[model samples]
Target chain A: MSNPESFRELCRKEIHTGPTSGVLPGYIQANLLILPKCVAESFEDLCTRNPVACPILSKTEGRPQFLRNHASLIKQGTFDIRTDFPRYNVYSRGKLVQQKNNCVNEWSSDHVGFLIGCSFTFEHALEKAGLVPKNVLYNKNVSMFRTTKFLDSAGIFHQCPYVVSMRPYKLTEVEIVREITRKFKKTHGEPLDWGYDGAKRLGI
Target chain B: MSNPESFRELCRKEIHTGPTSGVLPGYIQANLLILPKCVAESFEDLCTRNPVACPILSKTEGRPQFLRNHASLIKQGTFDIRTDFPRYNVYSRGKLVQQKNNCVNEWSSDHVGFLIGCSFTFEHALEKAGLVPKNVLYNKNVSMFRTTKFLDSAGIFHQCPYVVSMRPYKLTEVEIVREITRKFKKTHGEPLDWGYDGAKRLGI
Candidate 1:
């Protein structure tokens, strides 16, 4: 059996400090979103309203152990959610700035953790099906872009251009690609649009 | 906390003699196919080749533990491969005849168990995502039809039009339906084609 503790230890010591893509294999990986509890209910409502941007795998209130499904592997150390990730960008007034580990000390009890499904989960499923992922092989984060489309909004999470992660493949493999995409709704399942080129006006 | 043993007990007592559809929630229920050892390798090969059709969840040499993933559950009794399922049909010369349970005792030792992913997996996911499953609500088996598309074959599993199981929805819900379909690849991911009235072609 794959050891979850060792996996978490690798992350804790900064040993497995790379992007958590393709790490846990069949185990689900999730996106991290922390916000004050005042905004938590609103964000949860937002996710329910616009599931594409925020597919809630689990949510943590006051404590982080609520992510038991994914956090089951974090053996010895408590998940210092702020630092365990390879890198973190803090947003203040919607402006992102880099932050170091242990930012949890700054966290108040009013904070809530939203464990959203990430592309990593579906990407792993694709590789298991023998479909190669060019972005992962190239060792680059997926090509993410802010789109002109609007996502359903609730409270603080307002309607904005949907952000998308893209991967390119040959036309021959389109069937298999589409097949894999169909199974991962929580991870932004199917492409919003295919064969989109950079030169086309995005209308953003 | 669901019990796999309860399912075994039902099979043993002949109390639950029906398709094991939506029986156990949150557990991975599988499609069972047993083949002789001589043809097992080829069938396994076929499963790998056409993964969308035959996602081999767990293949046992001779009816190994079906609930290997659930260690905590109590195992009540042995699962008689020849009789455990609610119904059995025997194939001779590539033609299947409905048979009572245990008719295949003579062919038992020569058989190997192949558990493939079933649409039940994705149906669970869809229900979790709050998507309505029209077939379930209407009390019907999912609509299945033979497609003109050929699946990659192995040995006796010859090239034939893929048999796909489908559920329908209005045109307006297509995108949301596709999104839910993307998350469950083991369950035949997505539709190969849509809006084609397959039932009429099948003379159903």
Candidate 2:
């Protein structure tokens, strides 16, 4: 059970009870968004448009208990969208309504799930390169701000404010950070804004 | 105005009416599929699963005149899902009903468009790498075969045979070809199989 796959098995068995972060280092972890099949495409469009905030790793419909969705990528198994994770926040009608350790009852046959990427993946690369971000140095959560920027609306999805994640680096280190992170486009590649002038550009 | 963008401008105005191949050598060309919003997610899932046959570059809904999606990528303008392409084959009720240079009348606000990648993009990469495909050497169309393999079915998109496009190379050259093309994952990313055994494996 030392490997991430075995760790996922523990998660499936409800034995490993904690957040998935840092458990699966060097492997891409995902932020999950499950929705009814009816609005799946529209929300996918929103995520595609706002990739920095919602870079999609994989998406599928009706396949419960699975994440990476190609038939080639997955074996017949349990990814139970409901029980695979340690915990879940249930949203209804665009609002967070409840929290649960297991969401098996919340899932339906027509549900679609998106596995999105975040800064977590590339932050490892940053750490390996010795460009530890100020957030980590200070032991603080990455600063996140909702920019006035909005994603283009898709069907039934409108006015999505593009959220930005901020981690400060020395101005001298910005170029190297960009060089390291841009290669991982799936994980929000390169900062959207940085330094004083870059901050001004995003109007942060 | 000699670049691909200007070429697309010509396409938008209907001044260019020919197959969009080799015109923009360094730029990515796409195969377009548009469907009503109702079944878009199902089809997208199918494509995502069968990426070698249908590598998606971008997809969008509602923005009728676009190809590369995302609010960041597009300005309000005309790629005219219909008029931007040099030609189109219109399918109706599961049959190819008509071929036209202009499909404007066929589009509606509810339509979703997917821009899929093909061997076209990486073929350029191969040519640049000095490993001209046998198809190009013989000046013939790339050989395409419908394998018994089927794409993982999605809603309303079922029983789809996974198509394979074959372009031969010397056995010794296969690895180099693979190395060159694999980086371009958007464009099918390397050969599915290679050499005589590879051919036999496909039962072609």
Off by over 4 Å in 2: A1-204, B13-16, B67-69, B134-140
lDDT of 2 by residue, A98-169 (tens): 987777888888888788886877777888899776666665567788764444334456555557778877
Model 1 Cα displacement at A197 (Å)? 7.1
**Local distance difference test scores for all models:** 0.63, 0.69
Tens-digit lDDT track for model 2 on B1-204? 467667767877778876553456667778888888888876775565455567788886567665454546665663466777777889998899998877788878888988888677777778888987777665566788875444433445655655788877788987788678766667776566667755564456
Worst lDDT run of 10 residues, candidate 2 chain A, spans A147-156
Tell me which residue pairs clash in candidate 1. Answer: A182-B181, A182-B182, A183-B182, A183-B183, A183-B184, A184-B182, A184-B183
Question: If scored against the real structure, what TM-score would every candidate get?
Answer: 0.47, 0.50
* Clash count (model 2, backbone only): 4
User: TM-score winner among the candidates?
Assistant: 2
Q: Give the DockQ-based CAPRI class for model 1.
A: incorrect
